[model samples]
Every structure is written in structure tokens, then in C-alpha cells.
Target: MAKWGEGDPRWIVEERADATNVNNWHWTERDATNWSSEKLKELLMGLWVEGEEGKCEITEVSKVE
Candidate 1:
């Protein structure tokens, strides 16, 4: 499985005019300001757990653009 926050390798930071490959799709990280609380919770749960006592806690969320 891919690591969280590292993003997908198929994602590009810039757009290509002659882009014709599915592996070269432009994907940028947009601001999460408009995300709902439920949406955030779902994402947090997707995190990898190490042990039985592993717990995920989200204390703060920052605005990204």
C-alpha cells in the first residue's frame, strides 16, 4: 500500500498541453478548507495501524492550496 500524504505517483504538479497518458494526469493538492467534519474523519481512518493499541488522533487541520 502507498503511504499517506505522499500522494500518488501518477499525479503531477503541473499541467501538460499534449498530455495523452493516463499515468500523466495532473493532480494538485487543493485546500481542504471546504471539507466537512465527516469527510475528514473518513480520511483519518484510512491511516495505517501498527499494533492493536494503535490509535489515530487528528488534533488540527491546516489550510492547503
Candidate 2:
């Protein structure tokens, strides 16, 4: 099983989660400018379960341009 840092854009399907330093994410890739942060924020914020409120962490994201 391999582990990825917070700077990583993807995670492997490992049996366990590994910890890594991400103080500097300069190695991280950038998405296209066509993507709208506001729209994405709105969509992610809509993950509420209504009657059953909960929070989720975004482990993955992508952009098409």
C-alpha cells in the first residue's frame, strides 16, 4: 500500500490512510481558468442531507476545458 500527501491530487485505494507533509503544495497541479470557484463552492456546499445534516471532505476534483 502506498500513501500520498495532502499536496497530491489523487489517492490510492489502500487499506489504510498514510500521513504525509503538505506544508508547501507547490507540486500540486492547477486546474483550468474556465472553472468557476463560486459555482463549485455552491455545489459542494449543497451536500447537506437536509434532515440528516453531515459534512464531507472533497478528496478529489477535476476540471474540463
lDDT of 1: 0.59
Best by lDDT: 1
By summed lDDT, the worst window of 10 consecutive residues in model 1 runs over 56-65
What is every candidate's alpha-carbon RMSD to the true fold?
14.6, 15.9
**In model 2, which runs have C-alpha deviations exceeding 4 angstroms?**
1-35, 48-65
Question: Model 1, stretches more than 4 Å misplaced?
Answer: 1-35, 49-65
lDDT digits (tens) for residues 1-65 of candidate 1: 55666778785544458665555354655666657655776676556546688866655555434
lDDT of 2 at 23: 46
lDDT of 2 by residue, 1-65 (tens): 33454444475333335434254333655674556765775577535443456555654345423
Per-residue lDDT of 14 in model 1: 42
lDDT of each: 0.59, 0.50
